[model samples]
Target: MKKIGKTLKSACVLGLSGALLVCSVGCSSSSESSGGEKTGKKQLVFWDKSEYVTAYNDMMKEKVDEFAEKYDVDVDYVIVNSGDLEQKLAAAIESGNQPDIIMGDNTSVAEYIASDQLAEVSDVLADIDLKEEAKPYAVFNDTEYLVPLSLTAPGMFARQDVWEEHGLEAPKTWEELKEQAKIINDPDNGFYALGLPLGESGGGDAETFIRTIILDYGGEVVNAEGEVTVNSPEVLEAFKFIASLYEEGLVPPDATTWDDSGNNSAYTAGTVGVVFNSGSLMGTLKDEYPEIWDNTAIFDYPAAEEGGQSYTLGGANVFGIFKTGDNTETAKEFISYFFSDTDFYNEMVEAIGGMWQPVINGYDDTEFWQDPDNAVWLTAASNLTLTTAPAPTTDTAAQGFSNHLCTKALQNIVVNGMDPQEALDGLEADLNELYQ
Candidate 1:
């Protein structure tokens, strides 16, 4: 929600390396050793990309320290930008100087696993089904290599005050969203009924926002075969609908240059009624801005047409042990300890402020999720997904495609104004290239 400052304005594939790649990783060499011997306790280096990892890292270290005292092991936690993990891992891949554990995603995680750089952790959390949302990135070559950290799906949110003032509820259908957008877009009153930050690099934010709308309209960004299928007629209609929103003046003109915050800004300022992103925002909103916080509400992606479902995408941060690291067994042991213990998992979540939903807890009793604070996320999680959960389909293809397609493909469409069909066509062609 920080004002769009240093982030690039586009979400294109060419820019994926820039946007999602590590901008800079906060690393510590204290746990490092002089050669093959480690000095301090039986410590292991664990790194992942998450600015929101403060509490989790601390708790992780706490658990590791406890384990270290009991089992004689050391766990030093390091924070890296999500984008940086790939860059650093790519550099360290050939050097065999990798950390004992790497935390990333299926897309990013695949590179390590494919090269035999990661341990097959099938035994670590064998009891964990990992749910579908996690499978896409967690499993590779039918072998599980990662531990899932959270339940992830993008969510839609709005200012509760704006909804009440406009006599609206979360739109159940796409038409209703559009209709609601019309009423909120009374420019004379300094409001936009809806938001689409087009300026986030050639509509990068627009592309993501629009992709959900496309799903609502019956489009699938990823198919069962793990290939991109966004060029279909159903998706074309979705894209055309987006273009129409732009032409109809539903989106702010300045949206194209904005980063993720444009929508956040407008919503918090009461200038816009609705926006879609991670529900994690609710926690931050609660912590920082209290006055307008109560006006917030969560929404499912509205259905396209009337009966269609809304499906937004989300990714999870994963934990993996490197094949080259010194303490391979210990690394896996810590991860096992992390997941098998429910209290430890909750501590991590509480520390991270629900920025992540525990993946292993997918079958978490429906009871706690109904708490007023979690009500919106529970609904948003259920509403924004087309599936019970999202686990990736084509393992190799998913990761390679992610590094090759996912963010970049969407970026191309957003920045290039590449015709939705043509853009996706190009993405398909690229997927074949990676597959080869």
Candidate 2:
């Protein structure tokens, strides 16, 4: 229900102009025409993120094909690798030939908004039936720019049988988790209790993990007023605590070099006792590793304090329309058509097998969510703390996150053997530079 009258247009003009000047050099021509007309028919170009689960991407292709056939439009749908999307998008934007719609994570969406490369989609949101919780994530500066497609969060996947063999219940608090980890962590036997990644190779997993801990310890990188506060006592404590985990050998020795798949591979290979990941890992286990899936129990992150709320770092996967395209209206129409059928939408959500949560309401009665494992994701979706929790969801925070500042700080401490306070001071300086 937020409104932005003319500021949206003015901001878009300023952002697009700046981006064009910055990226005008050495850009390649895009496949589609500027007017999006092909063979005497209107065309729609879409760039979708390649999901971890192949079925998700396959189903999306089916949906796109169906939409194209129904609308009689020439559709150019491309599935791009998530890691390569940012550079590709910038190049397209520079050439003024970006796609009509692009599916991206929250960080990418924030970058688009910051660059004024996205069209305001408040009307698209108003026409759809959205969950109240999904609203905040799409809005910035009192205007909505993206339409959320699905929700995801990181949850603790633990080896239930191992914990049972030791006659222990699941850990409920961070302290309990460490204690349990210390007891069950048998490095000589090739089993580590925590498969947490502290590396910089992956996509923001380490950053997300470190931020979750910082928030857990009552630290804030930037306050609500947008002032840099990452150098506080709470952040120093959080940094020291994370360092202690690596020092105590609770984490794997090679965890320093892990990419996004490092923890997933460790857990799936039966060398790790616990991992924090999205439901994509759950799908992988269910289909390919049934025996391990049977032993796996999905739990929320342990509370930082006893009897306190547990926070998961997550947000929505959204569709953002670029301002550089001429098929904005057609793109919006496709989105409406995509969600128009209740049964089809439900099937899409169920096809991923709990990897995606519903952003629209009225899915409470779905039988898929009644399963205990799937239900855990449903609950975590509602209890998420976004990467920019303490501060507003601004472009600066997103840029900092995309820059992997948090993971770099951890590497400075755990890998480079820098003092925690010194690492934090460096982090504070970097964040303040971004904010300014």
Most TM-score-accurate candidate = 2
Clashing pairs in 2: none
Least accurate stretch of 10 residues (summed lDDT) in model 2?
A: 25-34
The most accurate candidate by lDDT is: 2
The lDDT of each candidate is 0.63, 0.85
Candidate 2 residues lying further than 4 Å off, grouped into runs, are 1-40
Question: Residue 266 of model 1: what lDDT?
Answer: 74
Over 4 Å off, model 1:
1-43, 127-137, 186-190, 197-210, 226-228, 257-262, 361-368, 379-392, 395-424
TM-scores for all candidates: the values are 0.77, 0.90
Mind sharing the TM-score for model 2?
Answer: 0.90
